[model samples]
Target: MTKPDNPNKTRFGFETRMIHAGAAPEPVTGARQTPIYQNTSYVFHDADHAASLFNLQSFGFIYSRLANPTVAVLEERLASLENGRGATCCASGHAAQILTFFAFMEPGDEFVASNKLYGGSLTQFGKTFKKFDWHAHLVDTDDLAAVRAAITPKCKALFVESLANPGGVVSDLEPLAEIAHQAGLVFIVDNTLATPYLCQPFDWGADLIVHSTTKFLSGNGTSMGGAVIDSGTFDWGQNDKFGGLTAPEPAYHGLTFYETFGDLAFTTLSHMVGLRDLGATMAPMNAFQTLLGIETLSLRMERHCANAQDVAEFLAGHELVAWVSYAGLESDPYHGRAQKYLGGRAGSVFTFGVNGVTGGYEMGMRVVESCELFSHLANVGDARSLILHPASTIHRQLTDEQRDTAGAGPDVVRLSIGLETLDDLLADLDQALHRAAAEGDKAAE
Candidate 1:
């Protein structure tokens, strides 16, 4: 076991941070890799120490639900990669959203969100949020005027995705952040699709970021995890908007998070309060797996982007194809935004459509079923190719207008490009599309 030189003070490049940030050699055995602290509880040295840990006066492993050492390493590593002050890991992407909202919202408050987002997120915001009397105003985030108009006195946050999921629109972050700031609302960007490898939303004025680590962060799709990272620049105490952070926490004997934790107030409260009670905590083993995935993120993303470009190009010229919606394409409407925020790559997951409404739907399904290499699954950001018709699967809960507005129309098929060789991947699409076209031809009779 080799002792790593000071993980806390270590400063390196993005790639280096992805691999070594927050990762220290094991104190007991000097293990080079982060060890999974799978135990449920940690021993408190004395009565004073226990009180200190419980009161948030000191930071140490208290319980698995509150925080685990292995998960803490992952949280720190991801926060460093994204240039955030700190981060908290959650059980799933949806949990991250809920926990983040818990920091700035109470019953009856509303927030503006992008209409075009992952299907699961739309459901979470549209349906689940209603249960708590919280509301989500889903609008076109691309429309600056609409976003500005949507904000109300009760609005607490502006939420949008940096690189949208199936829609693949590269959101205009700079202006939207300004709008949120002007209205005294927190700006939260879901950096799931682009990951930290592609886009850093905080640099574009976003105050906080959320990610579905289950997707790209765990590049291999081996673990289920999510994260909420705070830029630590949002002055929660600057205004009366964030009572949850600036006010005394009843759970912690009136400790105001912003007064005590300062820049890290959001993440600290999320861990001590939200995660403690909600219990949507990431497992130590999953965190360890996500750490392993982060180690190869840059490499995987480079290949994933290149492969996606190739796939998108191949589909665009196909006779059966109608339109493609990846920002990586030079002709894409979002190309400029992608260049500005995503550093020239539109990201891996994108949507495309075939010709007809009824016929196109059949062809899209056939192509998905015919694919021998690309899997027909709901997940994205895997090292392997994936295909799904979002209209019937992920977006089945929404109405026709909602589905169409979200770019999940009946004729559309979403693709999550992977790291497979260019030739083999192209051949797979060719076969799938051909089979799909043949099926359509037979149906015409």
Candidate 2:
């Protein structure tokens, strides 16, 4: 195994870290790649070692649910990529959200989130989270005043997507983070769409960053995983709100996580308490696959962004398209923000409205159905292009107002541009749009 010289001491570049961070030559065979340790349990050194592991007195793998060698490597790499102090890997993105909230929020506490979020996240926060007495106030983040107004004494955090899904809505992170910090609330940014390749949330003052590795992080769409990376700068002991971290725990014989783990308190709590009790552990195999996927993330994202820009430009000029919501476009509302945060590369996943004689829903559906190249599915960030009518699919459960607010209206057709030949992708979309327009014309008559 060729390893980076002084991996721990040297500050390697992002590309180097992606391949070598949190990894070393296999002790037994000197393997170059990270091996999937698919065991459920690990052997304890002795009786005292077992006790220490159980008591949270020391850090060692006791159960797969709490921690695993494969998942640990994934977590460390993600933290390094995000420039975070630590990270915890879980089964899915939703699991990462739950683990994050579980650490700081008690029952009846609340958080504020941008109205523009993933449809599943909207459902999770607005509906399912209510069942647990954890409330989320969805507000338009563009209205900074509205965001501040939404926060109250019970608000524990402020959440926003760095680059919102379905639509390419670029958030102004610096201000939002300022708002959260000024109010003594944790600022959580979901960087799923932009990925660390395009935007690093921690650099913009985000205290915690979340990702559904199911998307860009696992570019091939083969692995399902999520991660919550902690900046490890939040002062959990600064206020009484984070009792879960600062206060003594009954489960661990009164170990205060903030005191014991310091900057890594959130990450430790996620593994020790959240995963241990919630049982949303990331499979070792999934972790291994995701790690492999991340190896080519920079390459994939560069291609993804470049291809999406071309597609978006083509659609903006096409007769069958109404409007394109890609921040890469110069006319986009979020263009300046994208330039500031994403270095002018506004990710691959974005939405556009299809022009129809009768209605947009029908035309959008037709376009999606007629697409020969883009896969018709709910997923985004695949190596292959994907298409979906979010109003009828992902956001079908939400009200009309919720759908529109989330940028997934009846007129919207979301596209996840892939790393395909630009000419081929454009040709596919041109045919799909014309076919859909003709279908709509026939229906109108």
Measured by C-alpha RMSD in angstroms, how accurate is candidate 1?
Answer: 3.9
TM-score of each: 0.97, 0.97
**Candidate 1 local Cα displacement, residue 364, angstroms:** 1.4
Compared with the true structure, all predictions reach lDDT values of 0.90, 0.92
Model 2 C-alpha lDDT versus the unseen true structure: 0.92
Q: Model 1 over residues 412-436: C-alpha lDDT tens digits?
A: 8999999988899999988888788
Instruction: Please give, for residues 347-381, the per-residue lDDT of candidate 2 as tens digits.
Output: 99999998888798888899999999999998999
For residue 185, what is the lDDT in candidate 1? 91
Any runs in candidate 1 off by more than 4 Å, and if so which? 1-11, 356-358
TM-score of 2: 0.97
At residue 198, give the lDDT of candidate 2: 93
